[model samples]
Target chain A: MKKKWLIGVLLMVLVMSVSGCKKDDQVVLNVYNWGDYIDESIFDTFEEETGIKVNYETYATNEEMYTKIKNGGSNYDIAIPSDYMIEKMIKEDMLEPLNMDSIPNFANIDDQFKDLAFDPQNKYSIPYFWGTVGIIYNTDLIEEEIDSWDALWNPKYAGMFTMVDSQRDSIMVALKKLGYSMNTKSVAELEEAKALLIEQKPLVLAYVGDNVKDMLISGEAAMAVVWSGEASTVIQEYDNFKYALPKEGSNKWFDNIVIPKGSEHVAEAHQFIDFLCRGDIGFLNADYVGYATCNTETMELLDPALMGTTYAYPDKALLENFEVFLDPGDFISEYDRVWTEIKAN
Target chain B: MLKKLSSGPYWLWSFIFIVVPIMLIIAFSFSVPGEAFKFSLDNYKRFMEPVYLKVLARSVKIAVEATLICLAVGYPMAMILARMHLKYRTIAVMLLVVPMWMNFLLRTYAWMTILNKNGILNHILSFFGLPQMTFLYSEGAVLLGMVYNFLPFMVLPIYTVLTKMDNSLIEAAEDLGANRRTVFRKVTFPLSLPGVLSGVSMVFMPAVSTFVISDLLYGGQYMLVGNLIQQQFLVVNDWHFGSAISMLLMVMILITMSIMNRLGQDGVEQGGGNIW
Candidate 1:
């Protein structure tokens, strides 16, 4: 009689657990974005405004995020990846086209951030944050006004500055210095860029990633090739550091949000993206992440002190020198080989 | 029939987790990217290039150096611990192991702070009117990290062997007119050979394949074979080449292990299966 009672309880528990595996009625939107790229409180606010649950995830790099999404087991509803990756994903049909009717707040995005080369019609992605790559230097270390990429290669600054560790960013510096497009496909142009980088490798104190900001602030490296957003953060904190866009030009980047092709909660994903695009929410995110926002409404709400700052928001003429990174497609192998060879050497 | 039924789960687990993944890796290694089901030696051919060969050579060299350093430092530590009183031995062993309880990356990051240009080490140097050094982002820093992390692996196995060694054999050698140095040289060192061999392999394997230590310490200025394979899969999205590199690394490790096993066999026979 006791054995029968225990068996009955076990059967009941198993049934309950099995039923628990079934999907709940509440919608959950899975969002994958770069690490520390959002104002996390916005998620709670979003959940309050809409009943959809926000399941947030983060990745450290575009390549890492792309590899995960490309492998396809992760059924993320929305992802925020940079321009070139969005272009690649769209080409591969990994992205679902945005329904303009669903995303009404996208109209608040600035005109300059729209119809970018990656998304010519702005169909698949909405601009999340945009910034350019530039040099952030310690003014206290060098007296002369720094304006060009050649300062990185100067013998005087050897072992005093860091180059970005990223393949595209590092190669872009060399290509721009050589007066070639960052997205150059010609083997000769790439070879020249490779040679330039190899020559400059010894002078570089280190090849660093996002930690370049900390290194610069700590005065480990007197100068670093960094994204404008990171530079702006350091410039705001320190009196000695200054940001400069070199005369030879540099790459501009945009991180944009898009719904992945296999999203189960398409409507909730649209609602979340629209929520993020709202002016006050955009302002909160931009303020927290310290990146330039695409929403013009958010721009007006920004701190007046940061307006027209070289690192934060440069003038239109200075912006003309920046080129957006385009998807190199299969030609990226050349870049990988070149980068590996450089590091190996 | 009962035993077979009991072992069924083990067989299933191995088949699903170990056998299947290896088969997949082998299949991927033989194939070319963008061309499905087409087998090619192109990935292996690419790895043979001088740039990649140098990376492999550098990785082996660093691993060897780290292993040697561990052996040098750990052998003494093991001896000291083996000779300690029971009450103190436990405390000493725990001291060696306590830092390992912390996350490996966190420990490595702590080293970065100590070795940075304006870090604790530099502050001490400046305080004493000494020149500050750029100790981080160099090959030396990476080596230091490998040795610091893997030293316990080298010590623990050797310590177990030394502690388990028969005291009668050493006493017998002493009675046969052998001095302290001669007794240790003959009995202690030879019996400890199996432990030493296992320790070398344990330290060498992880040191060679560790990407995180070199990534954080050298700041990606230095490339190793592990980093190359990581770049192929994660950055370049070329699983074929990555798998090929992984297969090569596994083969290299197997070859080293077999060589060590051959050396350890004679010691194991003499030491009575305390190889650890």
Candidate 2:
């Protein structure tokens, strides 16, 4: 019996290694980008047309993605990072200049999204989707009309309001309320922003990340300072939920697709990017997600009602009052430190 | 024949499930992931931050407190069970074991349902003309969850020891004109120390590292060492830093286990006499 058991054990170990090994020979496109921000079926279409097997990857935050790419994630063929992150990546020399000549369908891009601060000549990043930060409120809960960033901290809405759980975002809102720059490098301005946040913390329901949409939807909090894309999704789900980019200045955050320095399958990636830029495909993604689109053709193809929704796409006056977050060199480390201190306290 | 048949299956399963993965983690612990999986030392200094150290210390402190509470609460309950009539003892044991049959995460969440500001506990308090209470998102909730989850482990071990205890020895003490207290101190307690050690090991090991309870009840406000490791892997994508921190935690656990082993062997050398 003992000898038989020993034989069985050896057989099992032999079988185990056989099962554990992977030998996938599929043409792999390792695409890493923001989670829940893309339609994965697009990969299936790409695969069906071109037999390149797509390996879909996701990152929750830009910093998290930055860390991966830094640690030799040259394995990834493409990544979508925000405009500021794209700027930081370019400065760090981590991106490849998009051979725009290879991508003729790039003419599909809207002029407004072109020539932004990150890539002045639009050399590196291909703008994927764009939106502004804003307040999402339950119209049933708030008695007064909400217009400005200060309305979030108003004692009248105390304990009923929630700001974004993110460090840069929440601090930016406080900074904007104080009429300071969203990209302020001044330590004095940052300190004042920090103090205002600490004071406002008592009024906060919680500082959370992706849970902002759920929190507002569940009626746990009356308002959440959230990405306009997520706010639009919520307003779509429940008609009573209202969204407003603060009457004061708001930050416009845009995400763009950039090929990293060591991407192996650039041509296929460009083809995939072109496929995404198609009017119907772009409209499908934007219609379900509710983020304003950078694809001019997608906007023209969207339902007139969806296009006209104020929360989905705010007017020009509101757009002018907004600022873009800049990659403020060494100030970011300080920004991170201040954010950590605020969270700690 | 029987030994051969059983031995092969056990060794095979253990090797496949336990030995190989542990070896992999230890290997990965040394090699930091670089571009194209190139090795580097850049990940090792990641946990030097004060934030991570505080969290590790907090985990250790909370685990120790939970283990101690389990010891104090479980030993007496187990003793009473071991002394009960057989039929009643079976019923009591069933009752004690039933809570374990439920899902641990589900049970922890139930505590949240009862303890949140608008939860059952607060509603009861308000009904009694007392003010409403906020019990969720506090350290007390975390400790409570830990104890509730681990109490079964504490009680079962000590019960095993107490049930195996020789009643003949107790009678012998009584015959020598010794009181119950003296008998217990001299005989009963020493016999159960091994069970106490086992119980402590089970509760202490898990409580020190578990992150789910804190996340669910405490709003994940405070980071423990476990949380740091999770954030590195899931959120930060800093595997090298994560590996370095994991190596530190492994060393900490090893040092603790070595001391425990030495003390445990000393216990054997002393004939298990110093139970109290």
Candidate 3:
């Protein structure tokens, strides 16, 4: 009787501790990725075709995803991160290299997307989507041509602007505005950028991320420092919206897919990446997510409006002026401290 | 000896989970701070920045204000329930507790649908010919979210102690021509202080360290202690300073706890209502 009573108490504690909203519980294939970075239908299609119950989870920022992936004790099967993160993960040896022979459909990816800077020689990661950092604007709200970086800090547009809410992007803007390289390694340039940001902070309505799309479309903002892919999405919904690579310079970036080390189902993970990279699937994914697809065939299926939009696919001259964000390593803490100081101020 | 063995398990838990983590944090705090390694004590020195101090001060102010409101609202509600007959009292307390059945994150997120610019509260305000207020990303929203999440914890402890009061003592006070206010001041209120201390401890610590609700509802517009620690460990990739901040927060909480314990006589000499 005592043993039965003890078992009953334990079960009650389990029940009380549980939140109990999970119903899609079979053998779960957990795929973790950055927020709004994947096509939902691809997961559904994978489920229907392969009969694997895919559990899709999202993280708002790269750091958040890393925190869970680090502390979760190797349970995640598949993860996606930006290029710099892929480099760091490889250095930490936290990822297992993909077996390229198992993923033949990866051939659909354009040659330009392959063997990129973050993973020279292409050992650990596969490129997902590539974009350039630039100015996304409300063309109707501004009367002047915005072919230069000065258009962002114009006094006439005070309280009418937004910018990326991060040390890297915001500081890069100041660096470029001052005619310096976007990836300025000089501490003097960074300090100058910090001062420039302090000047611009009051003019900012809010430092926002995901809300930029809704706010820009609704006319709450006239311009924002935005990702090219996000700029593409918002531009499709409103004619007045447009984006450009500042005449000075900008950052070029690509997100990549990789398997975290100690993945239990490496085969399924590679299969998923391969399946999504096929021409039709890649096209659908690009169309739905409103990002530039890396596949050459998928590029043809893109909406002509999106195809012709200079912001989505910048002219070669503009693309040439872009620099990739290198992993700043130990300097990251200083970057964080400076950012916290800015926010607190 | 059984006494030493009995203390051993608790000591082990404290050392492993609590003390060791705090020590690790302190060590990280003293590292020759760089982006990566070759550590120093710069993070602690860096903590002297006015912005960090402002964030710390704001977190404390908000936590203290929430604790007072929880106490003021909780004390009366707990007393009334305590005065109720046994059958009705049980049902009343359970109703207050049923809202906790929902997931904490889900409950906090639900507040967004009610307080956002286009949310239900504004919709009702428009219908009533009142001006709509954007409440979602403000400091008030953070307080309301914390209070809602933690009120029950405050209520239950106070209620448990209030219910244990002998009716005869109140009757005795009234027989001496003392009015209800005097009876409460002289007899009931002083006696219920133990429950208030327990309730305060339960509510204040969690409110100060709240991680998710404030971020979701306020859209990360405000920085509290938890968000600061989160930024350090995750975004900045600086676990050393992050650990130091954790240690600092722990020390602050310990100091507060000691002060509270002194006020409540360690809540031991004060009688506890039976929970088991």
Candidate 4:
């Protein structure tokens, strides 16, 4: 009699637990993005309005994201990779073509961001944030107006400046100062760039990565080669610092979101992407992350103070002089060797 | 047989985590990437370049310097701690270990705060009317980071050996009319050689292969072999080259360990069962 009663209780518990799980299980969309790239509050709002769940994860660099996706260990519904990585993924068929009918807010994207060199047809990726490389200077230390890349090579600023310790960005600066294309593949052009960098090495206080902000804001270095977003972010905190677009031109890079091939919830992913594209939503994210939004509608929604800043949104004429970094393909080895030689010095 | 069967989980864990990964690395080291997993020597050939050789030599030099500094500092502290009363010995060991409980990166970054040009160290120096110093982002800073972080590893092992040492040996040497210096040189030092060897190896391995310490404290100006491997794998997307470097590093470490082991064995033979 006792055993029969225990069996009845067990069955009741199992049925109740199953029903509980069914009620709480919502459409889950997995998102992979750059570390600290988005406004996290947006996720909470989306979950409340749409009754969907978000599984958000972040990677430090594009190469790390590519390796994880290629391994197929995780089922990520959406991934945000940089321009060159998006090109590589599209070429390798690791991404799914977007269904535009589901994303009507796609119209908000500026025409300049459309038909990009990485995804010319706009079939695979959506532009998220775009920015150009420029020099950030400390005004208190330098009385002169900084307008050109040559300021970095000034002997007077020796041992008082930092350069971005990235192979492409650093090499691009040298190439541009010499009046050559930032994407030059010629051996002589690259060698000249490497020699120029070696000449300027003594003047550099350090070759740093993301720590350039702290180094500059604290007056440890008089100048740094930094991205436009970092300049805007630091400008809000320190008034002594200012950003400049060099007359010699620089690399304009973009980060975009795309769906990897192995995702399970494609429709849910589309909904999330569309939700992010709303004008207000885009403005909140751009303001929070301090990056230039590619959304034309978002620009209209932004305050005049934000729209007026050239660091946040540079003039169109200056952008025309910028070049995007292309995938170097097999010649990437040459770039690697050149960078190693410089660091080894 | 039943007791041996209980160790199955450990064997499985080792095979999955250690043995398999090592095999994969060795296989990848010999092949060209983007092709079949067939054999090729090109990857290894690339590491024979003068640039890579220089990086490897510098890594060894830094590791050795850090290890030697740890030994010089740790030996005296360990000895004093071992000689302390039971209550105080516990407190001393705890103090040495407390810094390690915090994240290593946090500790290294703290050094950055103290050593930067306008940092706390300079502030104190300038307050005294002394010249401000550029101490951060230099080789000395990197060495300081390595020694500060790895000092505990060097201390604990020697402390353990000193504590376990038989007290009668020192008394025996004393009764034979040997002075204090002679007792330590002949009795204490030889018996403690095993701990010293292990401690040296422990500190040397991590110091030799560290990229973060140099990258942060020296500002990426000093690229060790570990940084070279990291650059190839993550930035250059050349897994073949990275694997080759890993294999070379492993062989170099293996040779180092064997030499150290031989020295330890010689100490044991010379001590003639003096160590417990």
**lDDT of each residue in B1-276, candidate 4, tens digit only:** 657866987999999999999998888898997874789999989998998888999999999999999999999999999999998889889999999999999999999889998899999999999998899889999999999999999998898888988999999999999999999999999899888988898899999999999999988878898899899888888888899999999999889888888878977764332222
| lDDT, candidate 3, B16-124, per-residue tens | 9988977666777777544444567677777777888898898888888889889888888998898789999999999999999989988997896788666789989
Candidate 2 per-residue lDDT, tens place, A1-345, comes to 776898899999998888765455556778898888876677777788878877888988887888789769457888999988899899989998887877776889899889998888888988889888888889998867777888766778866766665668888998898988899999999989988987877677666676666557656668888888888788877988888778778898889988888888888777777777787778777876678889888889987787656577777777766899888775664575566456545
DockQ score of each predicted structure, in the order shown: 0.88, 0.19, 0.27, 0.67
* Second chain TM-score, each model: 0.96, 0.90, 0.89, 0.96
DockQ of 1: 0.88
lDDT for A108 in candidate 3 is 82
Where model 1 places Cα greater than 4 Å from the true spot, the runs are: A1-18, B270-276
Best by TM-score: 1
TM-score of each: 0.96, 0.76, 0.80, 0.95
**RMSD values, in order shown:** 2.2, 6.2, 6.0, 4.0
- Cα distance off (Å), candidate 3, residue B193: 0.9
Candidates 3 and 4: which is better by DockQ?
4
Docking class of 3: acceptable
| Colliding residue pairs in candidate 2 | A1-B1, A1-B4, A1-B5, A2-B3, A2-B4, A2-B5, A5-B4, A5-B8, A72-B35
lDDT of 1 by residue, B42-157 (tens): 99999999999999999999999999999999999999999999999999999999999999989999999999999999999999999999899999999999999999999998
lDDT of 2 at B159: 93
**Model 1 scores what on Cα lDDT?**
0.91
Q: Tens-digit lDDT track for model 4 on A1-345?
A: 775898799999999999987797688889999887899899999999999889899997788888889878999999989898898899889999999999999999998898898998789988899988999889999989998999999999988888887888899999999999887889889999999998988788888987888998777888899989999999988898898999889988999889999999899999988988889899889989999999998999887687656588887777667898887777888888888888887
